[model samples]
Target chain A: MSTATFPEETRARLEVDAKEIIGRYPRQRSALLPLLHLVQSEEGFVSAKGIAFCADQLGLTTAEVTAVATFYTMYKRRPTGDFHVGVCTNTLCAVMGGDEIFAALKDHLGVGNDETTEDGRVSLEHIECNAACDFAPVVMVNWEFFDNQTPESAKRLVDDLRLGRDVAPTRGPDRLCTWKEASRVLAGFSDGRGAEGTQAGEPSLTGLRLARERGWTAPDPDRLPVGDDPEGGAA
Target chain B: MSTGTTLTPVLSDNWDRPESFTLEGYRATGGYGALRTALGMEPDALVDLVKASGLRGRGGAGFPTGMKWGFLPKDNPNPRYLVVNADESEPGTCKDIPLLLANPHALVEGVAIASYAIRSSQAFIYVRGEVLHVIRRVRHAVEEAYAAGLLGKDVLGSGFDLDVVVHAGAGAYICGEETALLDSLEGYRGQPRLKPPFPAVAGLYASPTVVNNVESIASVPSIVANGAEWFTAMGTEKSAGFGFFSLSGHVTRPGQYEAPLGITLRELLDMAGGIRAGHRLKFWTPGGSSTPIFTDEHLDTPLDFESVGAAGSMLGTRALQIFDETTCVVRAAGRWIQFYAHESCGKCTPCREGNFWMVQVLDRIEHGEGTEADLDKLLDICDNLLGRSFCALGDGAASPVMSSIKYFRQEYIDHVERGGCPFDHAKSTVWGGTA
Candidate 1:
């Protein structure tokens, strides 16, 4: 671990937040995950100083904090860029052009997977499924959905980020937040944009829309007859 | 033969509304009515109602939800806990995230109602960290519930105390496993704990805990508002009630289709405008990638617990990832193996090492650099992982690898003969024909 610690003012401010996090659980050790997020928000990645801060606050050793941090993919071992651009190269997304998009972004940004650009504007990684499979070939910049992406569109997305242009996600908040700002939200702090954007995307509403279009509604619960299969066909 | 009559929209009914995520928006649609109803009834009666409703867990394992809650020992003095598994990371399983994004209060209300049933005062929702917006929505909903006096001590002045905490999980697929989720919540490496006590006996600080899926818990409120018979009336005799059938990949209109269990994919595909333009279904997963893959022949298989099991695959999270003729099974299986191998917790040797070896073997075969013996070698690794790993992660890892070979052995042979994947990757992508 690095001998350096957070400067006095930063340490004092973080300790107050750490107190609130530790209080959420019955035991202080249970706060490690969120504390790690808090530190990542402070520094771009979980630095050695950050681990010491978490360990000191949570009453655990730095070794314990490092072990927990290393096990999870989200905790960055080193510095991260302003935007963490992840291409969903999982099976469904890969088959639907995620592989091509990842390759295109790598070429366009002059970076390999998990590597940040020279200007520190973007870090690229091939992420597992972020659970938006209906919008296939998805990309996430700092964990915001950039759904239904093409190779060209993904390239343009990174260029806009690197160039510091305004970028909006397909579904969530109207404007994308920095990676650090997003991590703070994950640490249980609100950015106040929770209800800012379209709550449901089109693909998320396919069944409901179709049912409404066909005027289909569930059968009245009170009208159902008794003596139906109670065990529900267990035999 | 399935028509609009087969559809039942309980959880997804209000998702289309722009204001569905807000407390006011949800209240306008009769939100929290079930929790109020549940508060007036005896807790045991609520449990009995769930048992009578035949509501099974929607998170891959189809264990009866009420049965799981009943597993809590009456003699245990430790504070019981309720954990909602919101870590929806299964490849192609996309329903819970959307549900929370559009309507998080349903889950919050379910948490309060189920907490009372299990007699637990505190509940925690472990959402995956990748979805920052979903975390915000859930957190905002909890804050709103507290402001409205719908949560916290003596909720709604009914003498039922409840507190909800929304916890975010760092990226780990194995944490979706209930035991691992508990471990992760307690600030440990998310490795699956061995069962004996299970989570019901000793979980989350060695306390008696009831863990349920997001969908399973969210279904509780509706079951409370409607009687058990209403739930049983919608679906088949066994797999009663409705679930989100998430259709992804090359389908013409891919999305979440909430229909009763046991609806045939053949009928759902008909509703989804069949496979894109001219393509026909080649193979698909009955659930997520973890379930064994199925081909066009199994399209008529009823998507329920027993029927899919009888057909040699589990109806996992109902994530029906469809693929058409242009996709290569070998490449698809390879990518899934890579996912499992990457996500393996390394707690069990069979899954950790077996997945590592399988990845190399599948890669060699996919690259057309291996002999035909590689197929048997791939199956051998799966055999070791299926029943031998510490948790279901290993079994899930072995699924697509074994099933793809079983259905498309000739495709593996084609990759071998052609010296690489035979299918052109360009034709299967969304932007394929346009450019």
Candidate 2:
């Protein structure tokens, strides 16, 4: 492993961002994760320069910073493609078609897990549980969910990404951006795309909808004993 | 019992409303009414109210919420902290992410109420990093709360000042554990710390901290708004109040079912339109993949902390991952074991080594290379890893394997005998397959 330094211009920009991130925490060491993300946003992955930058900003040794950076799965150690396509291959999703989707994508792209395509358009990996089980067989591009996915749909999604065609998530912003832009947002810098939309799926709101239909409410102090039944009426 | 059950949706009540994530919409829907009510009362009294309400922690461990809150030191010179474990990484647990995404203000409001009750000024919501959309929604909600004087200094005209930071965790399932989450928040490898100086005493910068789950904190506003007795009246004696029961996998309506803790799977299955179209329920997890798998016979087992435990599994996160007859039990268990193997932090020997060996055996079993001796080896390894590991992650790793072997040993035997899975792969298509 060789040590490298960030460019002066890059270092200057990161210093400002690093200061802002460190300001959020009581102890400056706590900002190490976000700072690594910040540097990763600039570079494709956690370069030798990124680790050095994080260490310099947090007043920690490179070894200390490297340990934290390597421990987390998000921070890439090497250059990745523009679109990081992660298909959920956990239990529910795999059983639903995540396995097939992953297999198909690997064949379609002619690249294995964590491998970038020849065009550098997409990098594919099998992610564990994006926490959208209801929308099983979810394929996430740049961390935006492409829910209820199949092998064909997922392949089409990556194809569109590679062709520079417009792509939208199942329930996200109007359009999808490159993986770098998503990383910047995850680094605590908003891309002004925050206000696009923030609606959950219909499945997510099922309980609330069912409750409303039945006129079921949490027991109110003032309206106690208003209903004949102690338990709210069955929906 | 009625075929259809009415659920008192506490955390998810405002999920369907438009702009529910916004402060204005939340206020319109009587959100933060609890924070206001809680602000008027003494913090200790609020704690007592939660204690009397019997609100247990919704983060899988059914520990009493108020008791956990009360564990914090009363007169610590260092600032006491309130850390919300929004790291909803349990495989089948899907409620918290949706809760934060749809109605983030509910969690924001809950954070406010909890911070005040615990007398903590600084709080952090350690959300999983993969869900960028959820993180954005929560950040936007926090910004809204701050602008409306709901957060920051002297909240809601009350003298209580609090600041909430929404921190995103780089993908690690162990971070879902409270201690590991604290370490992650402190910018270290997300590994579980030994107890004794639990988060309540020395956590996050060596101060007294109260780490509550996303759902647990989100449920606080409702508990405070509607008195303790009101909240207590819902669930069973041991487990009180409504909780988000995440129904996923083969269920017809795989969604968050916010019902009382004592509700049975039979009733939930009915509500979910029963295992897809016509498939019969096979083995299922009452909680996430971590809890012991249950079968059709246990459908009537109440999903409370006590009943589920009595039925031989913890009421873990209420992540009911339903599997139908078409699914392969061995294959599913193997997948779960692989997750545990992948997520093992490599801190403790049992978890680190045991899960690795289990996955190898499980893979062999699933791929038709396993023998009867592999079954004995699997059980032996699970026994070593069960309660002997450093944290619950080790124990969780062994659960699906142990439970599957317990209930569906024949399935394992059949795999060995047949040299392959018995279930047809075509029947378990991701979509366009008959139930």
Candidate 3:
């Protein structure tokens, strides 16, 4: 019987990660999270095969890997859209009418929680808290945090996202720090505010004067580099 | 009654003048001096001191801040990480955002000190994707820390290196859970991670990580500046420390009330000038919406973990979302259930589907269409979903529904029995404006 073998490159990436589990842990399961990251990064998603791969790499049973993956929020067992939209439906944001925001996105994009858009452009997941209580009623599109979001804003956002419109410029995203100045605006409102997604004119997005001053990145959406013509320089 | 403390400062306690956020201002306020002092101490000793302090997580879960730091494996090649959960999205949990806005440096310094203790050269303060302004402020603080040599390589020449990166979530509530947060930080969709190997064991970048709430980390400076005994002296034993109780929703002075942890809600209400004029207490959340709901009956319950827990609720995130008699219990529960429903990251069935179903039932009841069976259905679903989810969100989402129904079933019954809300009809439309 003939058996398939992993390519050398794939084999190298698949090498044992005992380093993550070594030394005085309760068990081999301690390395589950790291193993999951490795498997997910290599496979782009955690399939049964990926779980097996993690199990093999970590010297653990497949059941253990599956259990760890099943345990955490970060591990995605299924395929998701390129741009994931996590709508906050917790205390602060929910009171502010995040319901309308979630509904508008669902209606506008034709996707509910965990279901990707028909075109696979976005996946909408209703999430508990994104931690920006000050900016209740917020949605995370891709990696950038858009605050004080309204249904109308969500509509514009979802629409622009579908069309692949330009992303608004943001500040300090490069540095990886929380924008403290936005709290001033967040403080302007109170809790139990906004019942459904956001007020008709709310989810006030732009923050602090400095944020506006610094330009932001829209995260270029070019799927393949081959299509664009370098009219000005490439030739 | 008032320290007359003044609302001038938002968060920059030790750095901004009133602790201003400016670089020069931070320098003047004895900012990096603590980092300098900390650098001279053996890293493990700092960890030990923190553990001795018995400081619990302040963001919400109240994990022992010091004990959490001690959990990092001392001998490991893996890069340990420190993540500050600045996604203060809890209802009535407004302290962190405001504190970060007013005092980003406090968190930054705390991060730096914490990084040094855990020997983690890399740290990330995971902010909520929203609150762009606070994100910017934290970035500025990080920039300041880097410039002052408090962050970046060999911080203060302690031979310890740390990089404080501020990664914002794509704005999902579940990301606040340390594991879900680690997932979000790794650039995945945000959802909660089941515990057992809490972030202390494996976290950011899948390395040994210390995930702390913003308040938990921010309190470090004070803890370090003073002593554990000083901190413990204030709050009751087993719940030792100070905390920021956010007073909102019809409070006379709706803001953060920083006091010893054991202080009762009655005292906090007094500090906040009591509920808004002519408004008496109805029901409220002791922490964010997750912990069980409390009412005027619980006003005197000591706002400590043990006391609150003993009273059948958690002192989670101390976000007092107070309501008054004017508010409708059914309507309020419906609104809160709507939040849990919408935010239920659906990885598990109970939260994702359960919250949605609960909201539907509550909506019918709120709209005077619900039957008594709906309430039973709500309870039944909650029983199945609570503690059955992949993360605590399921439990949190069911908290208000279960607690509200327990305390105010008649209010729900009244809605269904009367065929209309007995409370203000004016407010019913307010909640329904979403459609």
For model 3, the superposed segments whose C-alpha errors exceed 4 Å read A1-235, B1-19, B425-435
Between prediction 2 and prediction 3, the one with superior TM-score is 2
lDDT by residue (tens digit), candidate 1, B1-435? 334346788899998775999999999888999999999999999999999889999999999999999889999999999999999999999999999999999999999999999999999999999998899899999999999999998999999898788999999999999999999999999999999779999999999999999999999988998888888887877788999999999899999999999899998998788899988899999889999999988888888988999999999999999999999998999999999999999999999999999999989889999779999999988988888977899999989988998999999998888898887899999988332
- State how far residue A141 of model 3 sits from its true place (Å): 14
Query: If the candidates were sorted by their TM-score against the true structure, best first, what order would they fall in?
Result: 1, 2, 3
lDDT of model 2 at position B7: 80
Clashes of each: 1, 0, 59
Off by over 4 Å in 2: A225-235, B1-4
Taking all chains together, each candidate's TM-score versus the true structure is 0.98, 0.97, 0.67
Clashing pairs in 2: none
- Give the per-residue Cα lDDT of candidate 2 at B36: 87
How big an interface RMSD has model 2? Answer: 2.6
The best-first sequence of candidates by lDDT reads 1, 2, 3
lDDT of 3 at A28: 42
DockQ, per model, reads 0.82, 0.58, 0.06
Candidate 2 lDDT over residue span B1-435, tens digit each: 323456877777777777877778888889888888989999999889888888999999988889999999877899999999998999898888888887888889888988898899999999899988888888989998899899999998898999989898889999999899999999999999998788899999999999999888888888787777677677876787889888888877788888987898998887777887867888888889999999998988888988889889989989888888888988898888888889999999999999988988999988899998999999999999989876899999889998999999999999999998888855666574574
Name the top TM-score candidate: 1
Model 3 — interface RMS deviation? 17.8
lDDT of 2 at B242: 88
